[model samples]
Target chain A: MIEVRHLVKKYGNHTAVSDLSFDIDGGQVYGFLGPNGAGKSTTMNIITGCLAATSGEVRIGGYDIFEQPEKAKKLVGYLPEHPPLYLDMTAEEYLKFVAEAKGVKRSDMKRQIEYVIEVTRLQEMYKRQTKFLSKGYRQRVGVAQALLGEPELIILDEPTVGLDPRQIIEIRDLIKQLGKTHTVVLSSHILSEIRSVCTSAIIIAKGKMIANDTLENLENIYSGDSYVTLRVKASEIEIRRALAPMDAVMGVECTQLQDGVTEAKIDIDSDFRDKVPEQLFYAFASIDRPILHLAEEHATLEDVFLELTSQADISEESADDTEAKDGETV
Target chain B: MTAIFKRELSSYFKGFTGYVYIAFVLFFIGTYSATLNVRGTYPSFEYAIGNMSFIYIIVIPILTMRVFADEKRQKTDQLLYALPVSMGQVVVGKMLAVAVVMVVPAIVSCIYPPILGKFGSVNYASAYGSIIAFFFMGVALASIGVFLSTLTDSQAMSAGMCFLVLLVNYFQTTLVGFLPTSALASFLAITVVILILAVIVWYMTKNLLAAAIFAVVIGGANFIYYSVRPVKYGGLFPDIIGKLSMFSRFDTFIESAFDLTAILYYLTVTALFMFFTVQSLEKRRWS
Candidate 1:
């Protein structure tokens, strides 16, 4: 539903977003994952036509945002970094104003607003002025604003920011529900939020697209290697000897547990990740060293996110003094 | 555009700004009408509007200072930019809302001449003509105030700068008297004005090359023209500077027959400033 190509946004001497490109199809929750100042908000703003990119093109539902902003924006519902609420206006009044601005027909305005208010579950707070709302309610109002006009694409920039834990969970669940009918693109630094709610993710760092894939695929691909821990009925030297002939085993460390039982941690080549345990069982059986207990470990999304962002940070700061980082670490 | 207009209009009325502005205009105009038209037995109602035009300099800043400034301060302009509406729509919508607020006093002032005619004769043609001119003049001032609001996010700063600019515009005719009328003096004065214009362009765009080019083109043209026609420079610079004054044009309507030129001038000023407002907003997204 959205296509961004070679987008760049520069704020004078500082480059906020640079060379970022990604495509999002409809009917799924796509996580826009990035660390702070990673240009997530900038990219979202450009996509929603809130800001102009330095150079590049953004298309929404086959419409160029710059050339046909009115038609293009009609297909989008955007909740920016801060909820654009009039402090003096009641939530109902603000929603009505938004409904009218989005050109929702007068006949459908009430019904459309009611539907969004129901979807965002803002039934009770509709009459209250926005300034009186708590942070979570304010965010819900922002989300409700985006949900108006039945726009097929919803771009939310850090929707769960400044919300409490329970509110975050509610918003994530709300996003999951929204994903059933519309293409929901939400940017957040919270990995668990993306993992629990999003079907796919686009991870970016330093204004560049770094990774984009399904959650399962990303975990499997970037998890790198699988390590097997086993308790074997043999001496350490005997167990090591038995595993030494296997080409799949990259490295092995063995320790004597009790009497004749030995514990061994075997790092397997990623190419053999699938059959390492089964092959090891047969190999140990051939040497009469029975494999008693075994388990494999895989990396989590947190590890992947940290690894990607920190790597980008290092490369981004390479032109600066690396020695300066030492003091920060200290 | 209608959505924005309604919201802006409702905001003005919901808060005290609209009421306060109306009260200020009516209070001063009321005092002037009582003193000049009632007690002094003056036949012309336009004289009262003419004498009290200074209220616009103060009330305009209050009315328009928050129109765009508060949108920026609260970051609601993001909603405007993201909405299906164009920047032109937003600018025109808010301008029209301010015009509507300005119309309140104009409509109230209309009752004066009719009431004055009850006691004696009144020229309804010129009297009503002045009211129309007064409304357009308020709209023109409001447009300038709205444009000034786009320059900053702080309401206080917007109000301050608008007040300062309009205050200077109000006194520009009198201020012209203090300027030197000699050929060399006009030449140097115009050069300084061009330099200031270049500085403003630099501040807005932050492009030294663009500003430098503008300075050279305008300043160089001024030097060339002044050196070529030194004999024609007598008192010309002050008159040119006085041309920037908006309030003085309203005096033409009060002094003689209905001045269509003054109305056109007000409209042109309104259009010019509104265009600047739209461009300023578009520039913000790029820079």
Candidate 2:
């Protein structure tokens, strides 16, 4: 549904988004995982036709964003990082204007505004000036604006950044619901949020895309050590000696516990859980060792995120410097 | 375009900017009307508009300062850029919205001429013609403001720059009078103008060769012309500056001759500034 090719955005001598390219299919939520200023927002801006790329081509729904902007933009609903809003106006008034701007028919405009308001859950605050709304409500209103016209692709830039934990979960659930119908692309630095919500993930660093693949595939690629933690009523040396002869065990590290139960973290060549308990039973029976705790601890999506982002050595100094500058000014 | 126009119009009324603009215009009209029209018993309100034209140097900045510049500062320009709308549409839509703010008060002022007509013979034709001219003049100046606002994201900076530009334009007639009208002086001035134009071109495109070539060609052509017809350069600078002043042209209309040249000049100013505004917006994508 969206194709970004060799995109580069530069501000004077500073490059914002480097030669980045990616394609997003329909229906699944795609997470643009990047540290702040990893060109996540810039790429999102370029794709949504919000900011011009220094050099590149972006096509949406078969329409070139620059050459045929209006047609292409019709397919995109963009919520910028700051949530571009008119604070003085009421939420209803704001949504009405956006609906009109999106070319929603006059007959459907009222209903569409109402529908979006309901979707973003801004109905109660519909008449309240956006200035009076809390940060979370303001963000919901921003989301409501994007939800108008029912665009095919929804691109949100750091949508849940300033929200509280509850609001973040609400926005995440909303994004997941949005993914069911539209191609949703959202950028966030929070690894857990992306893993929980997005089907596919794109990890970017220093304006360069480091990784882009399905969540499962990414975890699979990073998923190497199928280690099982085993606690037994035996000494560290005895526990290691017992597992040392097991051919299925790749490596074993045993540590003495406070209650005289030795804990062993056993690395296996593969998933050897089924036969391990039985083998351990007989083996420990021979040694008169009692098993206390034997459980597998699988690697999570956070592990994958940490692994990928860390591998791409990129400086995130600019984003910090910019924020500092903005803070000083504000 | 309609969406932008409506929001802009609504914004004007929502904030005090639009009301402040109208009040500012009315305040000027009231003071000028009292001094020139009411007390002095001047038949032509056009004369009042001619004198009161300086009000734009303040009001145009207020009306247009936030138009594009504030959007950028707030990052709302992203919303504008992402929307299913062209930059031209956004520019023209915004220009029209400001135009409406300008025209509203002028329309209210329009009613004054007829009311004065009830008491005394208001030269209805020239008065209305000059008012029309004044409306177009405001539009032309506002378009210039829009173009300047696009140059920066800071509203204060935009307002300051716009005010400065307007200040130059306001004194254009007087400023032109200070220029040397000698052929040699005019020829030198044209070279300075060409050099400045070349620098501006280079700043925009960063194409040093093209800018140098353009500077040389224009300078050489003017140099040859001055050598060929030295007399032609005499009084040429004043005439050129005189023609360029949007104010000087308005004077011809306010003084009661329906100067088609003045009308055309206003239209041309509007078009030129509007074109520059579009270019400024387009440059954002490239830069």
> Candidates' DockQ values?
0.73, 0.61
Model 2 per-residue lDDT tens digits across residues B33-90: 7788888987677888889988889989989998888888877887888888888888
In candidate 2 chain A, where is summed lDDT lowest over 10 consecutive residues? A310-319
What is the lDDT of every predicted structure here? Answer: 0.90, 0.86
Which regions of candidate 2 fall more than 4 Å away from where they truly are?
A241-247, A271-295, A314-330
lDDT of 2 by residue, A1-330 (tens): 988899988998989888899899988899999887788878887898877888889999999998899999999999998988887788888888888888999999988888888888876899999889988998999888998998999998899998999999899888888888889999999888888899999888888887889988887688776678888999987877787788778888878788898888888755564677677777888998888787876567778777767766534556678889999999
As a whole number from 0 to 100, the lDDT of residue B41 in candidate 2 is 82
Q: What is the TM-score of model 2 when looking only at chain B? A: 0.94
Model 1, position B1, has a per-residue lDDT of: 94
User: Cα lDDT for residue B18, model 1?
Assistant: 96
Cα-lDDT of candidate 1: 0.90
Which residue pairs show collisions in model 1?
Answer: none
Report lDDT (Cα) of residue B143, candidate 2.
88
TM-score of 2: 0.91
lDDT string for model 1 (B239-268, tens) is 898987888888877874798888898999
C-alpha positional error of residue A308 in candidate 1 after TM-score superposition, expressed in Å: 1.9
